[model samples]
Each structure stands twice: as structure tokens, then as C-alpha cells.
Target: MLHYFFKIYLKLTGWKATGPVPKDLKKFIMVVGPHTSSSDVFMGFAFRSVLKLKHIKFIAKQELFKPPFGFLFRQAGGVPVDRFNKNNFVDQVAEMFIQNESFAIALSPEGTRKKVDRLRTGFYHIAKKANVPIVMLAFDFEHKEFRFAPLFFTTDDEAADYNKILTFFTSVKGKNPELGLEHLLN
Candidate 1:
């Protein structure tokens, strides 16, 4: 099906996924880091296809669900969320995990492709609130590889956990290294 197509696409694009696949986990929050390019979405789709993890969904702004590219996003397991709303997104996304028998979502910790002072904590809070583990996914453009870390269960100590997460992703080089999280290591 589309999975095979995406797999072929990855090969054609000179990209490959390399890491341990978490096939046993029924639900978890996957944090993809160094999201320095819009092309990450297409690579993510190919990565998901290569890993055979089509069930892992992702959230985007409501506008991306509109015409033109909307259909493609929906087909790629995208769930639109209202970014302007006052509603608590963490709670809303946590509820999604509670309601589903098996649900996994991918989020970008950097939140934007631009350099940032620090990573967002929404993924951590959602994983903690939903009682699910957080998995780290790395986009290493230097190696042309999509890497995955094992299930990382959030602990009570937020700072320590963030340190560990940050350490894991700091070595990864993104499509746009200048805009990636490597600077946060300082």
C-alpha cells in the first residue's frame, strides 16, 4: 500500500530510519527533536512508514487541515488542534490517550524550526498526565538517519528528565543545524 510507497520514497530521497522500534508500546508520546525544516513532515511520514508505525499520530494547527495539503496531512495521521484557543491542549491530548485503546502522537519539542532558548514542556506534561511514556526520536541529517530511543517514562523530577532528554538530542544534527536545538546544549 502507501507504506511501500513511502519506503521507496525514503530510499529515493537518500534517507533511512535507524533505531529500535517500539512495537510493544500501545500508547506513548513520541518527541521528535531538531525539527529544523518543514521537510521534516515528509521525512517523518517516510520514517513512520519504514517503522510500520502508521498508528502514531501528530497534531498540527487547524489551518493545515484546510484545503490543498489538508488531505495529505489527514492521510498522514494528523489531528488538527486550535492553537489560538484558551483550552488546555495538554489535557485535551491526554484525554485522547485515555479514550483510545492504543494511541501514540509525535510532537516537536523545539515547537518551531527557529532556534529557541529552551524546548517546550507540553510533550512532557501530556505524557505525565496521560500516564504514558515518552519516546525520543531524532532527525540526524548528518547521517541521513531517523533515530529512535527506547520508551522514556517521565519521572517526578522535571529538570532531571529534561536534562536527559536534552542530552539525547543535542548530538543530532537537523536539516537546518543553525535552527536546531544544539545551541541549547550551552
Candidate 2:
């Protein structure tokens, strides 16, 4: 019922989804991109509903799970992560993935809605350590579409891998003007 509602909401809002739906869903890291607004979460939720993804989870700050919002986060398939604990979060998530073969975690490489120069590398490390593909999903408000790109295989050359990611984002239109990567090309 909730999923159907979200689907309807997405359609009403003129959001179209593109690309092939993932078939080999053993385990993966769903990397959402160009996250510049809270609306991105709504779009992602709608995509998850329309995709009918199962056993998928996303990371959130531990504080969101501390009080009145904890239940809401859990209900939304959020995994509370303590970023300040100094523990190796990527390794911890990788271990979790190894332990649960069906886990599919979503991560926003931007790490925030504000503009950032570089993406966080935690997703890459986690995907590499877990030996799972990184599924790239982008929300392009200008195109009014949600595009899913091919799964990324993490290689030893982190910079090269990031360049591929940047290229993918470059192909996506409607990126928030403030979050634009014009500086990356210079």
C-alpha cells in the first residue's frame, strides 16, 4: 500500500525512471548521486518502491536513531552509523555485508545535501571489501528523470574509479547548479 502510494506520487510529480532494473541482486551498494535536496530522499523512496527492492538499507547518522525518530528510521530501512566513533565504518559495513549475503545498502557519496568538492570514499571501500558491485542511481531534476547506470566494479586505482563516477554524473542533466562539478573539469 505504501509502495503504491509512493509510485503514484512519483508519477504525479513528473519523475520518470530510466535504465535497466538490476536482475542479479545477490548483494550490492546502491549509490545515489547529486543529492542536493531533502526531496532526493522522497525520490529515492519512490524509486525503491517502484523497483520493489528487497532487503535494502541506507545509512543515517546515529543521532537520528536516538530518540523519537529512531523507529521512523528503522521503518525506512535506515542503519544508524556513528561517524564520530573513529571506528572503521567501511570495514564494519563490509563485515555486515559478508554476514548478510542478501544485504543491499544505499549510500549517498556526496555525504550531504550541500555542495562538496569530492565524494566520500567510504562507499567504494565498502563495495570493494564486500566484493559487490556499486549500483549508480542519479536524480536529475532538470531532466525530470531518475537514471540508473551500470554497476561499477571497484578497482585498485581509486582515482581512476572516481573519474568514472565523475563521468557518469557528467552525463546526468538537471544537477543542482550549486552542486555542479564545473570545478572538476578545470
Candidate 3:
């Protein structure tokens, strides 16, 4: 399977995965951070595959569904969405969780590879609204490792939860270090 192959690839490349494997991660939001390069896609895929996560999905733009890699993307659980249209993307994704027996959506808080003043809070809102936990995944290029924080579920105070999430990312290093979190809350 692709999962085994990716695991081998990660091992050969000197990258190791470390985190707690939840018994039931079925319906949760995976907030992947420091998405600074196209390489993040491959790395993320390998990471998920190596972890053998089930029903892990990413809500990507519909445009990415075109061309030669479309099949591959779908195979990787890429859910295509019309990003340009003014639709309720969060609700749409939340519905996926409701419809599926098990679903996990991996999304970037930064939204794009370019530098940003702060991360978008959609990931947190999605998890909160959907009544699911947020799994914080970090690509620490400095340490040459992939790290996952303990499962996070938001409480009544969003600020407290956000601060806790930020603390976990403090030591994370992205492929493009310069572009990663110069001001994560600006």
C-alpha cells in the first residue's frame, strides 16, 4: 500500500514521526501548521500515511482536482471545495463529519505558504462548532522531525485555547523558517 511505501520513504529520509496515536480519531480537525512550501504536501502525506490514519482528509480548492495528480489527490482523501465562491466552507466541512462514519480534516492555520501576520482561526472554529478535538501537527524542519501535540479540545474561552496552541508551536521550525510565525497572533 502507499502507506507502507511512505513509511519506508520517511525512514530512508531520516524523518521520524512522534506523537500519541489516538484509538478513535474519527471526527476531528487536524490543524497542520508552518505550511511554507510545496514540499509540505508530500511531507504531510507521508506523515499521515506513516501514522496509518484512517479517513484523514484535506479540504483543498477545486482547482487542485484537475490534471494528472487529481487521482492521487482523491486517493489521499482530498475533498475539493470551491474556494472562490462565497460559500460556508466551515459548515460544508462540518457536514462531512456529520455524514461520514469517521472523518478527519487536516488544514493549515496559515491558509497559505506566504508569510502572514497571524494564523486564521477557522481550524479552531471548525473543531469547536463540529464538537471535535483539534490535533496540532507541526513540521519542525529544524529538528528534522514531525511532532503532534496532545489532543486539544476547546473550552468556553477561545483565547485560552489559542494561547495553549501557540505554546506548542513555539519550538516548531518550518521548511521556510523565515516565513513561519514571525507574529502568529498579529
Backbone clashes in model 2, listed as residue pairs: 142-174
108-131 per-residue lDDT for model 3 (tens digits)? 888899988777888887787788
Runs with alpha carbons beyond 4 Å of true place in candidate 3: 66-70, 84-87
TM-score of each: 0.89, 0.90, 0.88
lDDT of 1 by residue, 1-186 (tens): 878898788788788766777777899999998888999888888888888788999998889999988998898799888877787889789988999999999999989888899999899999999999998989899988888887788998998998888888888888888887766764
Which should have the higher lDDT, number 2 or number 3?
3
Please report, in order, the local distance difference test score of every candidate based on alpha carbons: 0.87, 0.81, 0.81
Q: List runs of model 1 lying over 4 Å from the truth.
A: 63-72, 84-86
Q: Residue by residue across 140-162, what tens digits does model 2's lDDT show?
A: 88888888888878998988888
Best by TM-score: 2
* Error at 100, model 3, angstroms: 1.7
How much is 166 displaced in model 1, in angstroms? 0.9
**Residue pair clashes in candidate 3:** none
